[model samples]
Structures are given as structure tokens and as C-alpha cells.
Target: MLQSIQIMALPLQDLKARIDQELDENPALEVLEDRETISLDSMPEKNSEVESYFENSSDPGFSSSYDQAAADSKQSFMENALSKPESLREHLIWQLRLQPIPEEFFQIGELLIRNLDENGFHLEDPELLVSQDQHPAMKEMISIIQRFDPPGCCSADYIESLKIQASLVVDVPEAIYPLIEKHLQALDRGKYRDIARAEKIPEEEVLHCLEILKSLTPFPGREYSSAEPTYVIPDVAVTRENGEFRIMVNEEEIPVLGLNSFFDQVFQESGNNDQPGHAEAKSFVTSKIRDARWFINSIQQRHDTLKKVALAIVEYQRDFFIHGPKSIVPLTLKNVAEDIGVHEATVSRLTRGKYMQTDFGIFELKYFFTNAVTGTRKGGGSYGKEAVKAIMKEILEAEADRHLSDQKISDLLEKRGIKIARRTVAKYRKELDISSSYNR
Candidate 1:
């Protein structure tokens, strides 16, 4: 049961890889059919007969060809297949080549850039990397590379990078430089009032500076990171038609698995044999067949749970399915578990790393389960945390130039019968990555 729970938590790519590993290790498990690896671009062009067959085919595997609910899944997965990402070093080197500096300067610049790590911080001291003859030019080379596209590469640390970036900003506040150099630690700790008192600046100005600091990229090279992009293939899909929701498990990615006929026959014969080592052979065959069947059953049950959980979500949050994400109401794992007659942990495992495709967009199954916003509503209905965030975002965007404070936003929310504290509003604002009113 624990192993089954563990398997259910695996995302689509991991699950596919697990099955492939089992196939390679177990000769008894055979792929009766598999469409998971098919390159849609290279698929045989559908003739009239193929199209007709696809339209009428009773075989469930052909659903990817004509399934309305999963059509987006097929198209989305194909488009998401990414090429290798460009490395940080490659990005910096390319910028260095375009500088048109002296040959020695260019050489030293390339060396400094190469010495930098993925975060664009120096792997070794720039001064130590150059010879005595080249020491005078090291500062120049480092400075040049730091001015590359990411704007803060080849720095001593994130603070130095931030300071460099601050220096480059046009019309930057004088307090900004000192704030980065001296008060960055206080800023990170959210001790805005203390920093203001120490610096003898207005509290509002300190907060404004904090927002500016937040805007700077701490890990500049991450923008051009070589880390592979993870592509998501939704495990389940929910589509609405005629004001009704349809739930489907993404079965296309799962291969058709069956025991090898030869292995099955051998297992049957081994049970009846009396030759030498007959017991050992029977034991091995029985173990393999049992393990194979367990694996296949686990995969099926994983999807079954996934589909059931998705259906329960659609039914429980029917408003979300019909009207989109903002209409999503408050829900929890316990709520869905009760609706589907399963344990909360069972629902959690099935929903983990699982995504659902909807008309609104693709969202992880975990996204639907949100804590309710506490407080009295004029209409007596509770709000979802996510729905509240969405409403807050809409309010902010619609009044972009207003630069409303958290307190003001909280007041506005109250007018709409959703009462929440100013601090909660501030927290959600940060979560949405919206700069404070000072920065806005």
C-alpha cells in the first residue's frame, strides 16, 4: 500500500520512466501497444481512410486522435517539448565577444565570465584569476562582464550584484545604494521600521526602497540557466459542454501492458514440472508474474484514483469548471476525500504533481484545494484564498496608477462583503509578485 501510494505521487514523466525501467528489467512484462513516444509531427499523415477509422475506432487508444477533452493535452505536450537551454557561461561569453575591446582585455573578460558560477557570482576571486602583468586589467575585465545582458554577472555576491544593478538604474534614489550596501539584511528580515529609524528616512521611503530591491534579480544568471525546462503533460482533463463537466484520465501516455505469452506459458508449465530445480524455476516464475501483475495493477489504480479525484473536484467546484478559476470556491483534501469516499491522504497522493486541463487553463490538481478565507460576508458565503487573490489582482491591475496601499485594498475588499486584514492583503500581494504601492 505504501509502495502504491509512492507510485501515485510520481508525475507523468517519472511514471513513464518507471514503467520503461520495469519493462527493461522484467522480461515477462511486454508492451502490447504503446503510443507514448510517438512524435506527433512525424505521425503517418492521415489518409481519408485513416481519418474515417479514427472517427469510428472503438479501440480506446485511438482516443488521442479524436478525443475532444484530451485534444488540448496532445497539442500542449507536443508544443512543450523543449530544446537544450543556453548556459550562463554561453550567454556571458556571447556578450563578451561583442564588446570590441583589446585582445588581452577580451581574454581576461572571458576568463572572469568563465570563473563565474550559475548564479553569476565569482567561483574564484577575479584578482587571483589574473597574472601580475594582467592584474591592472582584471578590474576592467570584471566590470565589462558584469555589465552584460543580465546586468550584474561576475560579482562577489548577491549584495554586490544588487549594488551594481542599483548603480545602473536611471534616476535611482540616493537612499537605494546605501540600503543595498548596509541595510539589505534588515530589509530581508522585513524590519522596515527599524531600518527607517536607523537610516533616519521616512518609513514609507524605506518600504519604497524595499520594493525596488525586490525588483532586482538576485541570481541574474538563472534567467539564462542551463537547467532543463520541465514539460508538464496533464494526468487528467476536465472540459465543460452544455454547462456540464467531463472528466478524463490522460490514458494516451500509458502503454498497453500484458504478460508475454511465452513467459505465461513457461510459468504454467513450471508449476507442473518435476525436473531438477523445478521448485526453483516455479518460484522464480511465480515471483516475476506476481510482480508484473502488481505493477500493471498499480498503474491502473493510480489513474483510476487520479480520474476519480478530478471528477470529485469538478463536481465539488462546478462553479470553477463552468465559470473559470476565479469562480473556484473554498475546498480542502478532506472535502474531496469525503465526496469520493477516500482518505484525505489518498486524495493528496493522487493529486500531487497531477495537472488538469480546463477551458480556463492547465492547473495542478493541488491548485483546486485551497483554504477558505475567514471572516463574515454580507451574503454569508466564504471566499477561497486563490479566488481572493485573483480578485485582488484584478482590483490592482484595474487601478494601476492608483497605487493603492494594502490597507486601502483591504477596505475595497470589505466593500464587496469580503472582510480580510490589511496584513493578509499584503501577504497575498507579495505572493502575486505585485510590488508595494511605493514601487507601483
Candidate 2:
């Protein structure tokens, strides 16, 4: 049980790493590479005389049970290996290689690529690349690099980036270039009426232009960011079939283990001999086999417990899976523990760093558990904090005409049956990294 608890606390990747380390340290433990079949029937039974020696000693329950199933061959080793992310510098260099630029300009392009920040904006002045005599050549090279795959990559600021991207579109309205160049602050503040009046265009046209602007990527270089991407392997998968939600444990990544047949044979053959040191050698082998068997069983037990806890979470948050995150109800570790017949600590340990892949998206197991926020009406059910946050985000997104203050947001939520205070709304807004009404 202690071993089960320890294994349960480890995430799937960490558990795989632990098993790899154990395989390196323990000679008795070996991976069964062939997946065609696994049968322990060929394993010899313990000799009657050897059984008498272990009968007197306390049994650690390792010899009682063994895994005989084969691992699923669908998950290959190469699939789990990490793939490095391409950086912005590499992407620009690749694009430069494809062009028919002269050899001398290639050095200038490489220098420009190296000076770009993570946002794809140049860090230094382009004029600094060469003397005044070669200023025209430097400007020409900069123009070429800016027109690479990610349209706005080599610009100095967001305004320049948007202008560069605007130039690439075939039928962009004549007013868009001026709107982005002159009235960026007004546009950010959602002052569409001001822009319409300034450009002498209709309000509807301003809205249409804004929609076109929205389609442009603000940070093009982020697509090929240099930072390493985190890879998550789901521990459980929830799928909807025939209007029913089904939960399945993801055991493909985990390897199926069995006792080494070679070690078993050696122990069996040596048990019958009466050499001076045969008994000590046999005892040592028995201890190693017992340890390996216990490790294998503990892994199986962890798998079973993880599945049970995951199923309980699915049952409790059924509405969330069917609808969406906004439909998530108030839940806690205690709720899942009670449903699955385990202690709260055990449930918590099993869920740590565990992720579940559903039709909606991949979410950590803890995302389903949320604190309850009381409802405004007396008989109404409490709301999950996550649900309240989702509603808040929607409200903010739709408030393009006028930003709603915290007090206004609280009153709106109260009308919807949520009993959140103004201060609480402000706190949640801050956590969402949303600015106040004035800033918006």
C-alpha cells in the first residue's frame, strides 16, 4: 500500500522515468520487448525443499501474484521522444536561403535575424548595420527580410508590424493604412466613432475595417518561438459516443512488466545443488525476485486507483464534459473521495500532475475541482469559481462599446443569480490580467 501511494503521486512521465532508473539498477527486472505473446506457464515451479526455507521466513506477498499480460504495441518509443521547437532565427534563415539574394546580402540578413527579439521585432536601428555610404544597401536588405514568411517579422514596433502586414493584403481598404498609422490609441480604446469621423467613413465601414485588422497576427514570430514546448500525455481520456460519456485510462505509454525467465531458471537450477555457497546464492536471488515482483504489482495497483479516481471525477462533473467549462459545478477532493470510496488525501495524491484529454481539450485533473460561490437567490445552487470566471471573461469580451466597471460587473452577475461582490470581481479580473474600465 505504501508503494502504491508513492507511485500514485508521480505523474505519468515521472513514473516512466522512475521505472527506467529502476531497470538500470536492478538486474532481476527486465523489459519484455516482444509483444507477440507473454506466457509464464514455461516458468518452473519452486522446488519443494526451497519452499521449506522461505516458508519459515515472512513472505512479502510478491510471489503470490504476477502480471502475465503483454504491453500494447501501438505506442512506439519514437513517439514519446521530445521534439525540439524551431526558433525565430532559424525560420528567418531558412526563408533567406530560398530567396535569390546575392551572397554579400546574406551576411546582412543573418545579422538582422540574430538581433530580433522574441516578438519578431528588431532590437537595434537598421541604419547602424552599415556606414552612411552603404545606407541604401542596408535599407534594401531590411526590406527583403521583412517580407519573409511571417509577414511582419523584422519591424521595430507593433505599428510598423501592422503596416508591413497591411501592405501584403491584396485588397486592403485605402483608409486602413492611415487608420493604423494615425489612430492606434483610439482604435485600442474602441473609439470607432472617432475613427469614422476622422476618416470621413461610415461607422459600419470602420467596424468592417476593424474586423480585417483583427485577422492579422500581432505577434507573428510567436508561432516559431524558441522556448521549449511542454508536452502533456493524458492519463485518462473522456470521449462522447452515442450521446454517452465514456472514460478510459490511457495505458498505452506504460509498459507491461513480467519477471525475467532467465533469472527464474538460474534460481531454480541452483536450488537443487548442495555446493557450500549454494544456499546463500539461492537466498540472495530469492530476495531480488521478491523485490522485482513487488515493484510490478505496485505499478498495477497505481493504474487501477488512477482509473477509479478519474471515473469518479467524470461522474461528478458530467455536465462539464457534456456542455463546457462554464457548466462545471462546485466540486472538491472530498466529493470525489466519497464517490470512489477512498480518503481525500489518496484522491489528491492520485490527481497530482495528472491530465485528462476530453473532447473539449486537455485539462489537469484538478481543473474539475473548484470552490463554491454562493448564489444571490436563497434557493439557487452555488456556482463554481471557474464558471463565474468564464462568465466574467465573456462579459468583458462583449463589452467593446463601453468597459464595465467592477461595480457594474457585480450587479450584472447578481442579476444572473451569482452572489459575487464588487471587490471579488475586481480580484478575479486581476487574476485574469484584465485592466480596469479606465484602461480598457
Candidate 3:
């Protein structure tokens, strides 16, 4: 048998946004005045006070003055950082206009600016520009922009950026200039002996060229913007005080909500009204009250769900909470969902945009769930990949000589309990920004 079953659920915050979108398209929806707007400067100073309320399309005869009243007192923090600065080419073109280059070279400089990369490299081929323009003026402009400040600001790449920097020193040896212009790769590779041999110069001379090279900023444009530090507001704060951990929802920042009491009285009294305008006013208040109550309830539900999920995480990763990162146990979303008797997706949704503050650090709820090392008895570890990464970090930290190759670290981990291969170890090491043994 086929049948249709209708189900009803209150809207979450995002669903409320969708409802608003729908209302924009729907003709029947209309905004009603809230209770507070009715009372103003001309009041008799009686005991009557204005109340807040909210409404949706479905309801027609309930008034809520409490829910909206609670939300009127809270504040939100959502400031964003300033955007990154402009590219190096934009900076150079401004500088180029001041120089009295020939008319032909000035156009070429403009062409060169168009081709410069974010790192201030001249990416466009001069030969291509010269052939297409067939004008000495265009070629001349390109060259002028190429010679703008930061030297290699318009060069095709870092090599040019460096060469331009080297050219600024009038007394720089001719041989040293060529070494930087051509053998910059060898210089970066610390192939001092090879560069010196090729240049027929002493290693000491190569060092001097490198000293000059080191003075230039490869990405000079980055210096334009001041680093704007962003502040993170934790959804939940868990701190240890007096030998016990305390869990608190940071409700101070979230909007509080309650129903309007005066509106509720109006709804109760209006159902008995036979008067013409009285019924409509009652219906309006009723709808607003329902919406206000639903919004308040949804907010409460969001908090409740977050609390359950976070508490479960704390309990499962007890060692991590007690100690720190290193003690983090293997855990997964399924582990948490099953423990909470909710679907994994439900657990995921509850945690999606939430953060927890602890003595260890503020972290995303999902950050605690990671793939395990050795499989658990039921097939998965109760710990997170972060825990495994922490284990690898610990092994490398205590390693002899303060450094260990990925292979050696893998071997040491296998001796303990982690069963990862050398390649996996290398992968994790790379993720941790641990350089190769030689580099370290």
C-alpha cells in the first residue's frame, strides 16, 4: 500500500532564513507591528508596559510577548579581517610614472606591469610584446616598469627580482652579478662549492653574492598590509579550576529569548471577542506569539544538542581532557553518535559550526574525531588521527640527536602500538612540517 504521511518540525536558524526567503516570494505574508512600537512618549505612566513578540504565516490567534523580549538584550561579535594588499605590479606602476623614461620605453613598462605575477615577476615575454606592438614606445614602457623599485619587481620571475636587486649595487663585481642572474638555483640549493667552481671565484665571493641576495624580499607586496589578528569566540568553555573541570556554554554572547506576557493576555481575551477589529488583532498577536515561542525553543534545542555532543566528546576523550593533546584517544563520529543514541549525521550537524575551549586549546568539535592507528576490537579505534599524529610527534621529539628519519620513526612507532608504514610516517611528518633528516 502506498500512502503519504505529513510531518511537521519547527525551523532551525537556517530554516528560518529559508522561511524568510519564501516569505519574500509569497504575496500573503505581511509584517505586523510588534507590541513595543505601540507605546511611545505619550504614555500616561501607568503600570502597562510594552512586550515583544514574533510571528509566522501558519498561526493566526496566539500572542507571545516573552520570547522576543529575551532576545532584545544580547550582542553578537562577527568582525572580519582586512583584505590582503594589492599585487606588486600595481605598486611598481605608481612608482614608474615619476621616472622620465623615453616615450617608447614608458609604454613597454605598462605592458610589463600587466605581466607581473603576485611575487612581482615579469611573466610576459618582451619579444612577444615587441613583435605584437611593433612600436619602440611600447617596448620602452615595458623596460621602464621592469626597472621599477624592488628592482626585479617587473622581472619574469624571482631570478629577475634578485638580479634587479643585485644591479642596484653599482660596485658589485661583474662576475657576481652573472652568478645571481643565472645561478640563483644553485645559490638556493647551498651549492656554494659548485657555484664558486663554475664562476671561477672563491667560495667566500659566492657567500658575498648570497649576502646581497638574502637582503631582498621575494614578495615585497606582502609588506603593504598589517597582519590583522582574528579573535575566536568559543561556543563552549571548559576550564579546570580547583582540580575540577567546569563546562559552561558561552550564553553571554548568544541572544536570549522569552515570550511577551501582555500579548499572551490579549490572545486569551480575544477568542471570546465578537467585535470586528478585536478578532483580527487577536489573530495577529496569536501568530506572533507562536513564532516567538518556536524561535526560543529552537535556540534552546540547539544549545541542548551542543551540550550533549560536547559532553560525550569530553567523556570519551577523558585522557585528552585530563592531560593534553598527547593523551587524545582514537575516536570517531560514529563512536559519538552511537553513544548519544543519535544518527552520525545528527551528531555531525550539531557539531558543524561549534567550538570548544579547554585548557589544551580551543578546537572544533570534529577535530577530536580522527582515523585510528591499529583497528579496534569492533573494527575502529576509539581515538582520533590527531592522537596518532601526537604519538608520532612525541616519538620524534624524544628521538636521539633530536632528529629521526621518517623510516626510523615508523620503526619506533611499530615497537609501541601504531602500525603505520614508512611512507605513512613521511606523510604525517610532512603534515607536521617536520623537515627531512638532512634538512633538519
After superposing all C-alphas onto the true structure, candidate 2 shows an RMSD in angstroms of: 14.4
Clash numbers, per candidate: 0, 0, 38
- Higher-TM-score candidate among 1 and 2? 1
Local accuracy of candidate 3 as per-residue lDDT tens digits, 1-440: 01000001221334345445534543233334333244567766643333223233345553454466444543221122234554465677788778887665656667767676666655666667666655666645655565666565655666666666667776776776778667877876678999889889999988887777678766654554344676666778787778766788666554334555577677677766888787677767878777565545555666676677778888887788888887787777898888878778777666665678998888877778867667334544444568778888888777748668888887777666567788988898889898777557
Better of 1 and 3 by lDDT: 1
Ranking by lDDT: 1, 2, 3
Write down the worst ten-residue block by lDDT for model 1: 60-69
Comparing 1 and 2 on lDDT, the stronger one: 1
lDDT of 1 by residue, 176-202 (tens): 878888987778767889988988989
Instruction: Work out how many backbone clashes candidate 2 has.
Output: 0
Which model scores highest in lDDT?
1
Candidates' TM-scores?
Answer: 0.74, 0.59, 0.63
Kindly report which residue stretches of model 3 are placed more than 4 angstroms away from their true locations once superposed: 1-118, 121-151, 155-163, 166-216, 225-227, 260-266, 274-284, 375-383, 395-403
What is the alpha-carbon RMSD of candidate 3 to the true structure? 12.9
